[model samples]
Structure formats: structure tokens, C-alpha cells
Target: MLKHILISVISNDKPGVVEAIAETVSDNGGNWLESSLSQLAGKFAGVIRVSVSPEQQEQLQSALSQLIEHGIWIKTEHIDADSAPKSDTTNAYIHALGPDRSGIVRELSRALAQHKINMAYLETALTSMPYSGDPLFDATGQLELPEGVDIPQLHDILDEIANNLALDLSLSETPFE
Candidate 1:
């Protein structure tokens, strides 16, 4: 029988980091399933899901630990069962842009939480405006809305936040399948 393992790895950014990790998993009889990895601030960090036979689990762990000597840190968690996906049928895409500032995410997230909206995907970036060279903050995300929630009211709430924060905010409904 195979068991799923959730693993996180972080190390100084360099070539061959991913190749090394993939080799480690493959050498231990584990199949690399899904992962999200990025290089930020000179460090490579990622979380990956893999499946291996129950007997190979410990061996995989030991092999992964060998990476520590090469400046990579590993953490592993065993998943006993998988949870079903949420069935909220309504989805919305949200976009916001503003001059860089603190607390924008916190405030907007608080409003979404109050409306019981689950954020399905969120991506944020900070870059300088093309002509002005001023720092600009931009964010985009998908939100799942619970049934019977008033979307116009949610818009009003977001509008209030935009006014207060001096940002532009927009929300559009995603077509139902």
C-alpha cells in the first residue's frame, strides 16, 4: 500500500536543487505528485506531495535528511486521509491595485472573512510603475462565495475598503459550469 507524504524543502538558491530533490524521491521509490516551488531572495523553497510504499516511507525520510548537509532543510507530514473539495458553487475574481502600503491585504482579507468568502487563489506582486518608478502593489484572486450571500453587499463593502485605502478594486462573477 502507498501512503501520501507532504514535504517542504528550503535551501540557498542554486542550480540543481530541484534535480537533487527529484532524484532523492525517485531513488527512494517515491513518485513526485504535485508541488509549488519558487526562488525568492536567494533561497529555494517549496512544498511537494509524493506517494511511496509504506515500507519505503522511512527510507525516503532518511534520504531526504541527507540534503540537510547540503544546506537544504526538510519537513515531512503524513496525510492519513484526503478531504473532499468544498462545494461552494459561486466564484468571483477579484483584482486590486494601489500604491504600495501596509495593511491592504489584512484589511481586504478581513472583509472577505466577514462575508464567509473562501479565497481559492491569491497572487500578489510589487513592482515599480513604468513611468513614475513609484512602487505599485497589485493583487488578483479567486474567491468562493457561499450560497445565498448578497454579492452587491459584498461589493459595497469592498468599495468602502477601496475608498478608505485609496485603491481600485473590482469583482466579477465567474460563470457557472
Candidate 2:
């Protein structure tokens, strides 16, 4: 039997961070399943899913823990496939941009919650606008809507938010690649 685990890690931004994680997994007879990683504010952070034989779970976890000595801190959670969240029936990619300001994420999340929509993943950043050098907010989200919420209705909600916040927003189906 294989034990599935989710690991989240954070460390100072540097090369070989990924290599360290990959090597640790490979050395433990684990299969590296899927991961999403990023660098921000000079820090490296990500979540990874891996699978290893039940017998190797403890040894593997201990080995991963040893990485803290090298400045990489990790947290692990063991999970089962059957216990995963229910799959969403509809998914869309949403992008938003406007002048940088507070409460943008809060408003967007509140709207989604009122409509019972789920945000699967979201990335947001503050950036500088070209020519003007104005502070701009950029955001992208992967949203999951359940069976009863139609896309057009969701669009209307987002449209209202954009108008109120002076933002440019767009939604589209996830691209195939």
C-alpha cells in the first residue's frame, strides 16, 4: 500500500531548493506526484504531493524533516484519495487588475462566498504601471462553481465588483495546453 502525503515548504530563496526536495523524495522511494511552487519577497514556498510505500512513511518523513537544518522548513499532512474534496462541475480562470488598494481580495472573496463559489487557487501581486509608475494590483484566480451557479450570473457579480473597484476584470474557461 502507498501512503499519500502533502508537504508545504518555505525557505530563503535560492537555487537547489527544488533539487533538495526532489532528491529527498527520490531517495526515500517516493513518487513525486504534483506541486506548485513560487518565490516571493526573497522566500521560496510551495506545496507538493508525494506517495511512498506505507512501510517507508516514517523514514521518509524523518528524512524530510532533516531539511530544516539547511534552512528549509516543511510541514506534512497524510491524506487518503477517497477523502478529497468533491470535484467542481464548472471551472473558470479569472483575472483582475487596477490601482493597488486595500480590501480587493476581501471583496472578491466575499462575493464568491455569497454565491457559494470556491476559489481553487489565487495569486496576487502589487506591480508598477508602465509610463505612469503607478502602483497596480494584479490578480489571477482559478474558480470552481457548483452545478446551480451559471457563468453569466457569476460574470454579473464580478462585473459589479469591477465597476465598484475601478478594476478591469475578465473570466474565461481554463485553457487546454
lDDT of each: 0.89, 0.91
Could you tell me how far off, in angstroms, the CA of residue 83 lies in candidate 1 after the best superposition? Answer: 2.5
Best by TM-score: 2
lDDT of 1 by residue, 1-177 (tens): 689999999999999899999999999999998898998889999999999998999999899989998888999999853643657558899999988899999999999999888887777889888899999999999988888989889989999999999889999875222
Q: How many pairs of residues collide in each model?
A: 0, 0
> Which candidate comes out best when scored by lDDT?
2
Candidate 2 Cα misplacement greater than 4 A, ranges: 175-177
| lDDT (10s digit) by residue, model 2, range 1-69 | 789999999999999999999999999988999999999999999999999999999988999999999
TM-score between candidate 2 and the true structure: 0.93
Candidate no. 1 TM-score: 0.88
